[model samples]
Target: MGVTLFHHVGGILVVFSLFQIFFTPHCDAGNILVYPLDGSHWINMKILLEELHTRGHNITIIRASSSWYIPEKSPLYTSITVEMGKDVKDFFDEFIQEQLKVQREGLSLIAFFKLTKKFMSFLHVGHTLWCDTAARIFENPKLLKSLMDSQYNLVLTDPGIGPGVVIAKYLKLPLVLNVRWITSGEGHFVLAPSPLSYIPVIPGPGLTDKMNFIQRIRNIFSYSIILFQQNFVLAPIYNAMCDKYIEGGCDIVSLLQDADIWLFRSDFVFEFPRPTMPNVVYIGGFQCKPAQPLPANLEEFVKSAGEHGVIIMTLGTLVNALPEEIVEEIAHVFAEMPQKVIWKHRGKRPSTLGNNTLIVDWMPQKDLLGHPQIKVFVAHGGTNGVQEAICYGVPVLGIPLFFDQYDNLLRLQERGAAKIIQLHEVSGHTFQRGIKDVLHNDSYRHNMQRLSHLHKDQPVPPMDQATFWVEYVMRHKGAPHLRTEAYRMPWYSYYCLDVLFFLMTVVTMLLFSVFAIFRCLFCKKTKTKCKQN
Candidate 1:
């Protein structure tokens, strides 16, 4: 009788386990609303969307009508298009042109100021445009009600723009950020404790984790410039939106801090060690995959390099072509290299193009990077490309054009996996030297291979890890336990300034009291002596 009872209980347990395995996935499907920033940021967001869709989550994307990369129609997610009159693509194109012109003029005080002012103006205008669009979103009662009725499990957004954060708050949904760069600067500056002693602030002249006294001071000053942009420039614009839309007033930083998770797009292999929050999940290289078979012609060209291997070059999505003179110089460098080169350039073909070089308007960058025949990558140091290089173990010769590219290159340079030839410093000699150093030295490739190994060694792949956390938030409603309540505190309290003031005030009072007691005793003794006299 006892043996029969035990077998019956075991059979019931087996049935329960099977039910969970088959049915839990469908039950876990959630409705997620995404507000993604346009341009390169949308690329990362789409990757996450694909994973979630595969896991049976329903996704809805909010996109601008003029969004550069996001498609209005896709099987991955349904998009709600906002009618935006502005086309920031031209603005970005103009800025890049101006930046190139200024940078090529070489370093100067006037040139520096001109470029900085232009960059800041671009930032402000971008924020303002989003702010206006967010207001229009709030103003549409029908749209607002539709969103309310949909009852999304959470808002998945890139906090590089403020609209998503604002919308998340208004809807009172759980927030998860797909982030590396936030509105002001690196995501950590706002989300975690950044000690300037070691953690260098970006957009300054390149400094590393190791710094002297002068460099530390420069870091603080650079950080102050970031604060100026955040508080003086961006806050007022977003704060206005908050006051109008949110039931109670909210701030951008507070909304960001309240997020349940941050699917951070970098790891220690590519990023310097720094303080990170519990909720910040490192999903660097999540978008990377094994190389697919290349096109017949591309494969034929790659194989033609023989044992020397091929070098691939591309300037990323924004900068389609370099200045003609720079392009000609780069072509000249390729002419000297024994290895064949494939360059993605939209400009007129260089007169110096060698028989060993092929120039195309596009290349399958990730697939090419994964190819064993590829020796070195000549790229703009964008986050996606940098991480991809690490994923594929390809050493880089970076020609950083503008905005965060130099900083990204600096991280790899520090690790000895890549070399940067800044725009102002790029010439045939420098370009050729950088390429040859990476290709022949062997150490650059070895170091990058080590990084690739470390990056791939994780138990859960970055993409799976990112998706698990997104679902975790959906299941739990929000991961408030992982989030820090420090954001809720006043600035003085958060920094312990009030406690310091109180302790100092008490010590000062005690010292004054001791002096008074001594002074009173001395006065009485002097009076007695005078009376005796």
Candidate 2:
């Protein structure tokens, strides 16, 4: 009886200790400054920031007013608008129009090479415009002085902008990076243990972990191009900005190398095999929550559909320049389907609007996906949208546009959870068939359900995991021990190229020396034989 009682008591103590470690809230709160990347990135991060605010941390977010407008005084957190000078934003607006025009042309079976060139041009223009905007922000003497005076305990930023690094350096704070997409920048490659061998780099042309020799070659080529664009084309502009703004002449590369933590908006199920270090955290689909009840009209519409269910189509915030012809084609297909469709169209209504389809400028996508009546999601394969679909166990019919969207959709198709219809090949019949295939095929549903289960089966919710790590970093003063030593290694040393080259040289010299000795011996022996003869 005594022994049993002792074991039981020990078990209880162990349980309590585990509970305390996992469930205990942090007593020490911090003042954190967050740098926002655009509207979509902000949407991805909003929930976690709110959770941190509720946990007693004072959060100051610097974002564009056009994307997220918070009142001057809010009880939850603070919002500081980063003013995008009038002409800059307008110029980007025009650039977006030109990009859309190119995409529209691409849909008419334009050559893939032409489309790629246009997309690259668009990316270059965007980076240049963004750099200019960032410079403007850093040049504001008042904003810079105020930010420096804020005395923040930590700084969190998206790697999409170089200004964040400059700001952090100027403020003399430990930096944490959050990437809102699967496609990574140079910082990720430099700071994390993510290598390109198995990890398909962003702008990947549909390469996967199960690549053959040819595919690996293609991946290497694509990775090289991406690196060139980031380091040569983009990094110089950022380095210039950093030098002009920061007092100590900060190197953007060094700043990223020393970053405290990396929060990735990705998960293992959606990504290929890759190495990751401790400081890296995957928080994919963290923004998804239990669905709120639908609005009255939407609820009624969904209910009216009955057994046919409904389909949801959204192309994300940045993809607003959809062509009219494609819209009409989609509408014609919707007209024939039994399912009612909710299309999130930001532009003028399609002339072919069917009775079975409803068009709205915006909708609560996650909530709709959670609804039992929502059967299929027609999306452009953006990371957030695809993750949400996977989270809700709703199969996707992906119409990928550009950048990582194609790669993301390819992964989904590989997993048997989705079907991808290239925009250039999309017609009424193709779009309808794609939707029907995902909907009627039992495999898609089963695969997506399995994915959802795997996603939810985590030790802690993603939000809590993010919150714990954020506060842990705060309590421990930046968690430097978690960072990998690879971050500090030189490029050549990091990949061991120098070591490999030295080995090759030694082996070559040894082979040459052996060959020379053998040849000399053969010649001397032949000479002796000739003399004897």
TM-score of each: 0.94, 0.86
Report, for every candidate in turn, its global Cα lDDT versus the true structure.
0.90, 0.77
> Which pairs of residues collide in model 2?
none
Candidate 2, number of clashes: 0
Candidate No. with top TM-score: 1
- Model 1: lDDT equals 0.90
Error of 1 at 464 (Å): 1.1
Q: Which stretches of candidate 1 lie over 4 Å from their true place?
A: 1-27
Candidate 1 residue-wise lDDT, 85-133, digit = tens: 6987877899999988877888698887778788888988888888887
lDDT of candidate 2 over 368-397, digit per residue (tens): 999999989999998889889889999999
Model 2's TM-score against the true structure: 0.86
Q: Which stretches of candidate 2 lie over 4 Å from their true place?
A: 1-27, 64-75, 86-125, 136-142, 180-188, 193-197, 500-533
